[model samples]
Target: MNNKKENIRLLVSLGIAGVMVAGILFIVGRFSSSISKNAMYDPPSPLLPNSPFPEGVSLGAKILVTADKTADKEAGVQAFASNDFATAVTKFQSSLQSNRNDPESLIYLNNAKIAKSQVLKVAVIAPIGLTLNEAKELLRGVAQAQDEVNNSGGIKGLPLAIQIASVDKFDKIKELDDQFVKDSSLVAVVGFGRDEKIYNDKGLVRISPGSPTTQSRQDQTQSGQTRYVFYASPDRDNFTQAIAEYIVKKERRTNVAICLDSAQAERSQAIKKQYADFIAKAGGKVTDTECNLSAQNFRASDFITKAITDGAEALLLNPRPDKIDAAIDVARENKGRLALFGSQQMYGEKLLKFGQGDVKGIVLPVPWHQNANNNAGGNNSFGDKAIKLWGGQVSPRTAIAYDAMQVIIAGLKEGITRQSLQKALSNPNFSATGATGKIQFSPSGQRQGGVFLVKVEPCESSQSCSSSTGYNFVLVQ
Candidate 1:
């Protein structure tokens, strides 16, 4: 009887302890100054049934300060709030040196290190004379990310800055590169077509050693400086491969018609080669067509008519944003029978503004989408904040560019130096969460997350798209 009584007493004590622990965690969740999150944030599945390939990466907001701040933690937080990441780092370090196991101290110390680092200043370059919406959208993402980070204690405490410039002449790439190189603050350039114009036969690259190939450029330097500028968009080879694979294996569309944007002939041609190579290897037929970007009212009826005659089941457009509408118009001109595919370059608001009821079943490989499946969207706190800040529709450019900036910010937290930044980028093993998905890079500096396919069609209301934003971007496999 005594032994039974002791067992009952032990059980009661254990149950009480469990309740206390839960209560502590609940309070922490509610009151932590900065809710700390791991590197990647993935929305709970089922809740995100709309996402096709839902296992991409996303950024999670985490706690940087604790409610029960120790003396050291309090001092560090004060310093952090004042933008003195250096002093905060010092205090955090002292606190850690005193108590090796203090969690808040360790966390604050990390925050201090990141905040004390150099500010990341990425250069945004576009064709001279205008603020290309894509570039502006990208900058907006960067700006939004910067504001969020700085407001939330920044990357340990350092904020991000951006510089916008124009490339008036392709031939003047060397001159432009030289001017950029003189500014040590400039770490990466987001635009600039990766064509020979920037690296002609004369080896016009100003960073020295020009380049060998996209595969080897990020690792090599000329005169101890970076030879390659990181690109924000998807790689040409990988992009074509993803689109081709989707059509061949998933969509099962065998006969494809290729349309090229004449204004972007060089880039389009490169992508076309990848498409042709993939299609041929897959034992599929591909027909080629050309479109012009300058045409105000583009109707590629000739191209569509010829493609249909050739038994092409799908039309793949390698065109600028202006041409996407034209491509859609021509497809509609054919009564919307053929499946349409495009690359990331095919982003525009007009698809919704005009092509709503007519443009359906159009598939494209984009790096980012306002996936309702993501925890950040679907009227979630992050998604609501994004809509309120940027207004209108959220373009893919904005999402990817914002994530790219986040990637650089994450890299700065590790160790702030050009070499550190480069290694973090060039290291294939390195990965982090962006607004879209998990982002990593290959040794060649190409981003490593798998491509996601979004299609336009009839859809119901969700956090990202509704009648207000026109059609929805359904994530198809």
Candidate 2:
């Protein structure tokens, strides 16, 4: 009986040992499978799954990152050019992983973010009942660009997203406000006009390419809370100041005329006071200022005649659409005798209607060009690439808008937060190395300086009118 019992115990011990061995093998198999499935460090593939490039983005900027590892970067750029964003992104990712000491990688990474952000997830909440077609176009550009950035990979690992709510009027805006309050993914917003009160009420960050605060547009103080709201340009007074200075230097003329509608006329007068003071500082003169907003049958012939008679050598005219035509007519009549100077508003597609002949000798400052010196901003390729992306024809506002997007993306790549944005905007200075020249954001969020100047050139095969085109900086004279 004792022998039989010992045998039973031995058999049971053997069975337990066999089961333990099988269990160990099963665990080892699972561990190997997991590593194989998710291993990012496997013998680096020649190409990654997708180009690390962001989509719908065109940097046209040269790398500003450091120079030590140019080979890896060059390889990445080649991949990007070949439309292998995945491979490019992977190479960049690997380089970044190997060493975080490359500044060029930072630039490359930023570009990658821009391309990626386009592919990010985004939605739009455009204003309803837009007053003009241009507003709609502006909103469209913002939405499409945002959408492209978010779907790809966003900055770092964060995904980009947007939501759209259409509010036709005041009452409807109130309803949309309630909806906006509940959303969690809304990082920023672009509005139709400066409805700061409504924008602030919803905790939505606002950006407006066109201001509701422009002269005679509306009182921005109604929603004077600027903490969450940012502007693309300066307040009316500052913009006028930049224009005034450009006029004096580029034209080498002193006397100027200020013309506008009744409301805008009043604002123009106010701006004139500030500029007149600046003129004295610059050793220039603001001679013969004209403010006319309500001149229904007002003819430019008479105004030009009066300006010339008053000894005004340069005219600073800011009239409404019809008056703009009249002023150009008057300028045409003078023809090289009096130089016509116009406000920034004068640089638009509508000006094309005045006929190039009517606008020759007219000078204005523009915000965009094709081949600016590496004196603008970005990696020295911001302008031409933007033009190509815009299909050869682009507006000044378009370039500014693009730059604004760049600013946001840059901040994100640097670990974007609300605080980072404010830091960038406060004295935000982009080295002048691209198409738009050097861009500096003043404390107030205005592009601190101007690089663009406008001169009227004859339209193709036409003598009656001319188009306002941007000339090379060297060719401005």
Q: How do the residues 1-477 of candidate 2 rate in per-residue lDDT, one tens digit apiece? A: 999999999999999999999899899889986553323122111222132322211221233222335556666766756656666666666765664434234334444544534322222334324322232334334433453455555566554433334444445544544443333333444443334555444444455554334432344333344444555543455555556776676557777655555545555566567667766665677656454646576665676677777777777666543345555665576676777777655665556555455666566655554434434444435544433333334455555554445445554454344434444444345322212444455444444444455565654443322123432112143
Model 1, residue 471: distance off in Å is 2.0
Q: For residues 1-477, write the lDDT of model 1, one tens digit per residue.
A: 999999999999999999999999889876652222111111111111111211111011122223334676667667766667677777777765665434334434543454534455554444333324444555456556666776687555555444444444455444555455444444444455434233221121111111123333423332333323344455656667778888877888899988766665565565577688888777676875455544555567776777788888887876554456665666567567778787666655556556676667778787666653356535653445666654444667667666666667776677555445555665667776766667665444455555678888765655445435467667774
What TM-score against the true fold does each predicted structure earn? 0.61, 0.56
Off by over 4 Å in 2: 1-152, 156-185, 195-202, 210-226, 234-243, 246-252, 264-266, 287-289, 320-337, 374-380, 412-440, 459-477
Candidate 1 TM-score over all chains jointly: 0.61
Alpha-carbon local distance difference test for all models: 0.55, 0.49
The top-ranked prediction according to lDDT is 1
- Model 2 vs. true fold: TM: 0.56
lDDT for model 2, on a 0 to 1 scale? Answer: 0.49
> Which segments of candidate 1 are over 4 A away from where they belong?
1-120, 126-131, 155-157, 166-176, 193-228, 232-234, 263-267, 288-299, 376-385, 391-393, 459-469
Cα deviation of 219, candidate 1, in Å: 11
